[model samples]
Target: MVISRRGLLQAGIGWLPWRAMPRLTMQLDWHLNAQFAGLCVAESLGYYRRAGLVVNLKAAEPAMDVVQTVVAQPQTLGCAEESLILTAQSEGIDIVAIAAMLQASPLALMSLPQQSLTHPRQLIGKRIGVHSDGRKAVELVLYSHNIDPQQLDLVDIPYDKKYQRLSQGEFDAVQCYALDEPIEFAQRSGQVPTVLPLKDYGFDAYSQVIFAPTSLVMDQPQNIQHFLSATFAGWRWAIEHPSTTANLLVEQYVEPDYQNIAYQQASLEILADYVLPKDAPRLGIIDARRWHESAKQLQQAGLIAALPPMAMSVNDNLWP
Candidate 1:
């Protein structure tokens, strides 16, 4: 199964009662966590309110398909991996990307630093834990390294158990979101795991992107733009003040006792590398060339039959 089948994100943060406010439901690509702090902060800080909108941020479940949800409810907007956007288009899902949430892909291979599993080639005979949705990326990494994926011992592990099992030596290495899982394990355990980002090995693809049905783009262009503007502002603020954002998140949005505020700050700090790279175009702006290249990578991994046609793959004009 692809990551789309494994999990998606959403969080029903809050809703305003005003009859005139445009209420939009946002479907996230994965469960709520520090990764979605910007969205949560946007709501808490009144960024959405200032935009004349009331957004319902819905957290995704392992069984729910974001594309299906967005398709069934065209008025809704959703976030997911860039490859999913291409795949959805190939399958006739008609979704258009609004902006890239993570400018750099966060997909990574993690292992104990002592194992020396620092490079893709080192895993030829080693057992590597992978999420069902992560198979294509693992394969792409292998191919990029001139190693056949068949040479690697790939084990399909559930998302929640990948790190735990890795710590127990169940897997020599495991795939994970570079920004979140490694920090999570480091916080829980004194040991820090070594990470080999797939992007470093040429399997880069956008991790989280905000998108909506094509009809929504055409019918309510202003709403989509407003949401993006407010979202970008929220992310800028979140990155600048992770500690404060984390506190706000735990207080109202995230589970107060379940998620530690400090841990949330740590994850967001690491995420700055992806969310706001040193010299990117700007926050939430999609790079057209990278978008096309990602489609090619998807095709190379055999996840998609072919690269999506330019017309169907991206709308560069959507962001500005």
Candidate 2:
């Protein structure tokens, strides 16, 4: 049975059929959108079912702490940025990243033509509206360009309302998803915005990471393996068929005005670049070097006290 809020709170693993197969729940870091195309495709195409598993896919809510939820709930999984996993790990949260979904982070700093902030250094003396969760990323970007964080004006904007404020001139720039806000703004305003992608600015990190309680990894290795294989296979299919997957995302998952189809397609195409970059070893392979670099960037930015043990932060063997 599909697990909703009420169902998840009440249902127990004992509620499953008396088979030994494991029942699991997956929590996404954000709301349903093209970003979750792979998981949605996996669900719609019966990949999860074929693996002899029952899964509950939970969409994100405001102020929802996904990692903490995984820690609090048993037999559950979560997807979030590796930076968050690292930070939580440093704070003594026992979690291990199993697979890297997006090869590069889509987090970006966006501004319209009037702002004319062409370079990262130009951010100084300007107000940048950012989500509190994204402060570390924005910090890394500023420091990478030798710009001191104190030199810029940072106003915390609710993640949901950033675009509205940026459009109304409340912010000279805002942190947002490259695939999402830029396209949405262009579609609405007919003017392309300047997008400074964090990855290009040396804030590279894997995004939409699949992570689980270390207990879950050790206790249910086979279940995790099956889930990864099927999930990555679903991603492969989604990447190969962006338009088809986008249609499924809008119709069955998050409904949008039919006119938004073009915007959806554009977002999917941009996501494909991050999900399947040139010479990527495989669709869902996590780069050990990139992870190390990500950790180093976080440490330099003072987000984490220091680098957590690599073995503790990631366990990529499960993906293969």
Candidate 3:
């Protein structure tokens, strides 16, 4: 999962150390890649430093849950999937969303060309591999298409082996992010796989959101606001200079797999669509419309028992 899982953003947020030079830890649910290029660029360009903050970029393992991490450490700002936020709320965990980087979620299903699975309805009787955390979304996608999830054969699989399983003909399709897996699969197998993005089938949710414990939002509103502004500024600059940003990412933070400047560039270019749409006024602006809609979608998916308190879940006041 790319917690940078999408949000095209990351690398910045609120909560500064009160003394002379402020410092904060930004827990990224996923590892370093182009998904967080905007954030990495902010540090690369010293945006956070100029704002009087030292942002520590921490990467997470596949099993590290950002929700619980933030809950355990209230002082840090964490990047996470929005659905997890709603799920946390259902479980009595209160986290406030300050801003979202990936406005349109990149969650998708990928299949080999031979399978030719392009639509949700095509999955009937097919064996599809699902990421452990992605089951609810898969179910919601099927429900949105007016198909019963029981009609398909769903298998739980590990993230690292999903694509390989698909290639071996063990499965027809596998859950993936629209931008991440597709490019990776193509580069690895030398073939373009068919993709079905969940947003197209009615399972749209925010992908990359900066979240903090309840007390942090209430206690440090001004610091959070300033951190968000710096983050948004970094996103703006990254969006405007995709090539330079990609290069910087490869030179600095990106891991070995994403060290390819071309690959990082491709990811950043595709993420442009998710980070900020054509008509978006600015980067990192969280809206209530998508917020409520996503909550409803989660309920329909049976991922959450009841809708979380919408008014308190997102920190809209953080924006200017």
The positional error of residue 244 in candidate 2, measured at the CA in angstroms, is 1.5
List ranges where model 1 is wrong by over 4 Å: 1-17, 256-258, 311-320
Could you give the candidate ranking by TM-score, starting with the highest? 3, 2, 1
Backbone N/Cα/C clashes per model: 14, 0, 3
Q: After superposition, how far is residue 254 of candidate 3 from its true place, in Å?
A: 1.0
Predictions in order: lDDT: 0.76, 0.77, 0.78
TM-scores of all candidate predictions against the true structure = 0.88, 0.88, 0.89
Model 3: per-residue lDDT, tens digit, 1-320?
00221232243444445466566788998888889877888788987776667778888877787888877874699987777787888788877777888887888899998877888999999999886557777888898888888899988887876778889999989988886779989999997999988888877777788888878878865556556766767887887898999889988998887788888888888999888898666577667677888888878767689988663433333333
Instruction: Report the lDDT tens digits of candidate 1 across residue range 42-136.
Output: 88899889777888999887757788888898469998877777888777667777678898778888899799578888888899988755677
User: On residues 1-320, what C-alpha lDDT tens digit does candidate 2 reach at each position?
Assistant: 01132332243323335266567889988877878788888888988777667777888888888899889999999998778888987788888877778988888889988786767888989999887567888888888888888998987778766667778888999888887878877777787888888888777788888999989988876667667766877788888898888778877887453336667677788889888899777677776667777888888777799776563323243333
Which residue pairs of candidate 2 clash? none
Q: Candidate 3: where are CA atoms >4 Å away?
A: 1-19, 311-320
**Better structure of 2 and 3 per TM-score:** 3
